[model samples]
Target: MSADLIYLVLGLALLLAVVLPIALSRCAVSAPIVLVGVGAVIGLLPFDKYGLDPVSQQAFTEHLAELTVIVALMGVGLALDRPLSLLRPRSWRGWSLTWRLLLIAMPLSIAGVALLGWWVMGLAPAAALLLGAALAPTDPVLASDVQVEGPSVTDDHDEIEESDQVRFALTSEAGLNDGLAFPFVYAAILLATAGPVAEWGLKWVGWYVIAKIAIGVIIGVVGGWLLGKIAFRSARESLAVARRGEPLLALGALLAVYGLAEVAQGYGFLAVFAAAMTLRSQERGHEYHETMHSMIERLEQILTLMVLLLLGIALTNGLLAALTWPGVLVGLALVFVVRPLAGWVALRVGHRSEPIGVAERWAIALFGVRGVGSVYYLAYAEGQAVFPELRELWSTMAFTIIVSVLVHGIFATPVMRRLERIRAAAA
Candidate 1:
């Protein structure tokens, strides 16, 4: 591609980033569908120079997806209106729906998908586990409609205005599970490199699961607490820096938490989210939270648009050519069958309060929107090890993402709107 062509494409993409969301705001159409459609159309224009090969550009694809996800994770953590709580039975009611989804729904979804991949899709154990882990976390990038808007302010520190159950559930689930899914991904990697689970089960459980999770949580809590103190409280002499309304500080914090956590052999996803949540809690009613969130949201929007556009281009350029009937079936099953079933089961078993009704549970269960997270995991794994069925894995993941963007995207606005109305009426 020439420099001029690149500029033209970038200009058009930036224009779409501004226009599409406003145009599609209250309609059945969604920003993702439109952005992807535009890219598909552009790809079909007989312009050989515009196509991208995701498999060939794996590192670029991984990093782009990684950046977009971390940005979204920060937004997710900031947007939450509910406070986090411990998982004791006495405190279960105080626990957020995010807890149920992470502790219950996510594992069910992962297991269901892994079994389907192995038995139904005929993938090997390692590949099946990888597919499960990759598609397990709900993508924050494409789930804007189902998430809390931004930082909410209230007079009483203890008064958390109840968010709509569906939004809270999805937002919390996506935020935490993005990090929680990492251990399973590592499990797949270990299995791929070292042969059988029997050989690495003990080490995987010790290092990948327990140790890494502990390190990530400790780092996130400590880092987030210190950053919050610096940003929100600091010496009077340095208070000017806190009041300058620099939202880039949020980005800086995100990078610091993520980079340091990863360097320490911890899960960066969890650390980034934990830090954001901790920071938000520091000055829960601060206008600066809104400033920081809005900044992250805008960046997330642009990156999401770019990724969906590339996905569309890749689709048009035969990304799904490797798709088989079995792959298509598995993809459809994941969105329409497995996720909903797993979500419903989780809620049924886990929910203790009367806050979430059947309709809310069903809506939350049905809308497990998977997008860039799956792409990142796949790309990251593909870089680490060779899988003979790489093409099929791509085809399955791509097909699933397309279905999610279209199906969930089309229904998200209308469904959430109706749910909000119902909650308001009930209130």
Candidate 2:
């Protein structure tokens, strides 16, 4: 096929990918479904019309997903309207779900999969651990249906209904877990390039983990606080940049906080989220909050569609060619079994305001959709170190991701709708 023809086809594909899905939004499916389908079709059409061949450029894939993730992280930060205090029991309940999921469920899921990778898949310990860390961060792209929407409001009189505690906790947890998962990935990389396993045991598993988590939180909090002050105070006073109604200024907050946190070797994911919370706290009743969130959300949706499309192209072009039975099995186990078990265990403590019914809890557990974070982790790992079974690992991760996307994507709206109905009926 001619280059011009390929370009024309790609342009058309992009247009259809965007327009058709928006038209279908009420049907409970998404842009992802359409994009993935279009990408797959384009890949099979005997032309190089829609391939992500640039992914063959290792640095490109590494950075594209990296950039995509951090951008999404910024959006997540900008959307949160809640304060981070755990004082009220309702607030504390949200935090409880978050902590249990992150501290207990996340690690347990990682460790279980790591063990499976080691024993069943016969991967090296480092590689196995890397897989665990890579899969740990639930992708916000697929979990958007359950996430909190818009900014926090301080005014009780403004009259917007608050997002449910479950949604807020899950959304916020996904935001920061991406960064927290990084330390484990770093540990795996360290082990991959280590001299002695014992030294790694002490330095990496012990000191490094502690230091990284501490630094990430500290940098996020401090950086976000300062950035919030500048955004609300300096900008308001200067009047030169004081467009109080425009939320695009939230973009400034995203960049400033994310940039500094990374420079300080902190988790940019955490920093972006903390910064959002900080900014929300600054002017809780400000009308700009929703405007900012709306803008970020639209951009996030566009990015998500593009990523999902590219992922379909990747898969259609044999991204899973190297996946062994064991590798594939492990990935499936994670989405279907490991996560569900861990989620159930984590929430077993019972909700402070009467736990969700078994049906709702199960629905929530099963929909821990894996998306962009797995892509970022795979690309990040590829950058840091090479593994003997890299192709198998990549294929497994991609398969799991695709499966999760389809399964969860198709089910999210329906499940959420049903849950809401159930709650309403009970009330």
Candidate 3:
């Protein structure tokens, strides 16, 4: 592309970023849908462009998706109004929902999808496992409509009625599970490279699961605590920086913590999110949280637009050309069956005492919209090891994401609004 054309495209993207949120707010339409549609249309135009093959541009695709997810995670952590606690009955709801989704629902979803991919879609065991792990997490970027708004001064812990249970559940799940899914991804890589082994099992459990998770948590807590002191409760001589009210500090913190975690062989996703949560917990009612969240949110929005637009272009350019009837069935089953069933089982097992209504549980289960994160995992895995069924994997993931964006985006606003009304009446 020429400089003039590149400048034109950039200008148009900025305009859409400024206008689309306000325009889409009046209807059930979502910004993702619009951005994707525009990209598809542009792809059909007669402009000579570079191809967007995922395998060929693996690094670019992986890093772009990685950056978007980290920013979204930071925004999610900062926006949460509820405090994390283990106290029974009163303060345990958030932690309970998060644990169920991560421990029970996520593993079940991975196993179910892997089985379907192997049996129904004729994928190899390793490839099937990769697909399952990649699609496991509900996307943090494209789920904005279902997430809580930024920190509010009036948010109170005692007023449980003011909380949106569905949003809270989805947001917290997305925030944590993005990091949690990495171990499984690594497992798939191990199986592909080393095959099944007795010795590898012990190493995987100890190093991958126990050590990495512990490292991520420790770094996040200590890093967040130190940064919080610097940003909020600095000594008298260093208070001027805190008084400056610069939100870019949040971005710096995100990069710093994520880099440190990755260098330490820990999951950057967990560390970034944990750090954000710890920072938020330091001053729950502080106005600074809003500023930091808004900054990250805007950056995430821009990055999401770029990614989805490229995805649409890729779709139009034959990313799904290898899709078969069985692939389509597998994708549909994942959205309509696997996630909902796994989510139901997890909630039933974990929340036996404080049962959620059937409708609410189903609503939460049904809305696991997969987006950029899936693409990132696939690209990352493909870079790690060659998969003969690469096209099939991409086709299934693309089909599921397309269906999810349309189905979930259309229903999210109305469903959430109706749920809020029901809760209000009951209160």
lDDT of 3 at 74: 90
lDDT of 2 by residue, 217-336 (tens): 676667666755665567455532324565666677677767877787666777777666666655667666677777777667666666666667667777777888998789889988
**Model 1 lDDT per residue over 1-427, tens place:** 3465456456767888788878887789888888888878877876756437778879988999999999999998888766663333553465446677888888988898999899988999889999999998899889997887887876665775555768877887888888899889988888889988889999999999999988887788788789888887777646534577778888988999999999999989899988888888777877788888999998898888878877887888889989989888889999999999988888887466646878898999999999999999999999988778888999999999999999998998888888878888988
Weakest 10 consecutive residues of candidate 1 by summed lDDT: 85-94
Alpha carbon deviation, residue 306, candidate 3 (Å): 0.8
| Candidate 3 local distance difference test against the native | 0.83
Predictions in order: lDDT: 0.85, 0.71, 0.83
Ranking, TM-score, top scorer first: 1, 3, 2
Candidate of highest TM-score: 1
lDDT of 2: 0.71
In model 2, state the lDDT of residue 266: 67
The stretch of ten residues in a row with the least summed lDDT in candidate 2 is 235-244
TM-score of each: 0.95, 0.89, 0.94
Stretches of model 2 off by over 4 angstroms after superposition:
1-21, 48-55, 86-93, 152-154, 157-163, 205-207, 235-243, 350-354
